[model samples]
Target: MIAEHAVPTSVELLRLDADSPRTAEVRRKVVGLRLAPGQQRFSGEAAHTLPRADTDPNRVPFAVLYRQTPVGFGIIDQRGILDEITAAPAEAVLLRAFYLDPEWQGRGIGRTACLALDPLVRSVRPEANEVVLTVNEANPAAVRAYRSGGFTATGERYLGGDAGPQLVMRRPVPYEGGAGDG
Candidate 1:
């Protein structure tokens, strides 16, 4: 268990599934996760998003862990899941509903978790060559965090979001055999 004031040094992404032994505990943690004030205008809470992800075959939910304790959540959407919202290419996966509990923010956990997405998505969707996401134009912190984690703005705007406009961003999924492997 993580201490209330302790900072996590590492982050890991675990697939959320009913069959896992830690499922109940992780779910409880996710249910209690809170976002900072005004953050809700940018991202969805895990508790609310989990149910939809549970029923959608194209959306794979993951629990973000720190020292084996759940502290955040994210979802990777397969090609067809966000076709209308993202207009991403066939080889891209959508990163959605990503958030770290308010208490866990600013500790580098979110950045580490974002960096881990490539391998996680590659393991599940081998054909995915890039990861795409939309960050609210008003949420500069999130945009910086995503940028620090290797995503770059695609110069496109998504106006379909509930909270005004969003900036589309993307990053290449690193090759399994390392750079220039292709």
Candidate 2:
């Protein structure tokens, strides 16, 4: 189910189904710019390795991370999106890849995307005591974003083949019936 959340001055976020054409463009942004600067593991190989589940029910693309709407997009996973992270450590769902369009950055949209996550994550797993994710070590900006939004690093990383290293961070669930658990 695609979902949207509003936060006054903050950017409005939309979680889209994988089939959304917006997914392709968003993935492209991550591949072209978002992953450069030693912050991501998205080499040409990983980019091409995008899941066959674009139209599948199990996977959904995260909102275009923009001011009014996503100038680009990001991808988040539920339970089985990836083999390593979910299979090894074993978590229920994950806030996965984040991609931002250059034109839409530098205005707190990234932060908005980060903040919006808490509610969406909690809504699906109201009983979930924790929410977890894997991020590349090179992405310090993202690390900072997660930290500011109440996540603590577990001091662990997942290496996907030779794609590079990803750090795992988590936050404890705060509200049983958060701002939007409907």
Best TM-score among the predictions, by candidate number: 1
Model 2's alpha-carbon lDDT is 0.54
Which 10-residue window of candidate 2 scores lowest in summed lDDT?
A: 1-10
Off by over 4 Å in 2: 1-8, 18-40, 43-53, 65-67, 81-91, 122-129, 178-182
Model 2, range 15-86, lDDT digits (tens) per residue?
543456765555555444434344345422224324443655544555545434445345445564335543
Q: Give, for candidate 1, the lowest lDDT window spanning 10 residues.
A: 79-88
lDDT of residue 67 for candidate 2: 39
**Superposed Cα deviation of residue 10, candidate 1 (Å):** 2.2
- lDDT by residue for model 1 (1-182), tens: 55544445677898885576587778878778888899988878988998888889888888899888888998898853357544546778899999998877877788778878877899768877788898899999999989977889989888888998999888878678787312
- Whole-model alpha-carbon lDDT for candidate 1: 0.82
